[model samples]
Target: MPPKAKSKKKGGNVKSSTVMDGLSTEDMSKDQLEEHIIHLREELDREQEEKSYFQLERDKIQAFWEISKRNLDKTKAELRNRSRERDEAEERHRVEIEVFWTVTGIHATLNFNEIPSTGTGPMAPQHDGTATKWYCG
Candidate 1:
């Protein structure tokens, strides 16, 4: 069996022989590690900011979609109401025309006297020289 190489530490409590992924921290100097950490933090901040911007855009789109849907619903309701009102008005007009035609037909069927009345009123003498009278019993 072969003896394994002993890992070394540079300073403080940071172990230089720590393994991350396939790369060993033993080859990286202290300054390099600190710079890598700072770069990673900056990259993380940029990603978080991008995520927040995307979230805000998504929220705005959702709000706009909701408003559009509500307006569409209102427009549809108005159209339906107008259509119903128009139909009712048409029905009323049709009914009025039918009633007018019926009344005109009834008037055409009736018989009316065309002779002018005498000036002596209802007690006037008839053409036969007899006084005309009426009795309601």
Candidate 2:
């Protein structure tokens, strides 16, 4: 029988899965492998510490964002209330002005004949048959 051909894996190129898997045990001594393992473990520890620090920073930023968003919502609500108050006050002022003008026009017309121009009051207008003159105290 012919020598069996070397079996080949039928797939895409695959690398060894572990940190030490790619290293050749035949080339490296036991002490070298142990030292490499220690270094890899230290590097993993440092990376884990850095990851934790970044996670804390992200949490802090999220808290700040929550506070800022709450404040913004509160400010928007206050602004809306203030705007409503302003609109209501302006409407009341407009109505007051209209009523005052209406009452003034009617009062002036009705009280025109009750004034004695010469000696009655300060609001009386003096007439000399041609032009009317007003005097103020």
User: In every candidate, how many clashes are there?
Assistant: 0, 0
RMSD, each candidate, Å? Answer: 21.1, 13.9
All candidates' lDDT scores? 0.68, 0.73
State TM-scores per candidate: 0.59, 0.60
lDDT of 2 at 13: 88
Error of 2 at 86 (Å): 0.5
Alpha carbon deviation, residue 56, candidate 1 (Å): 0.3
lDDT of 2 by residue, 41-116 (tens): 9999999999999999999999999999999999999999999999898778667756976887633223344454
lDDT score of model 1? 0.68
lDDT of 1 by residue, 65-127 (tens): 999999999999999999999989877866775697688764322222343336463323333
Best by TM-score: 2
Q: Which candidate is the best by lDDT?
A: 2
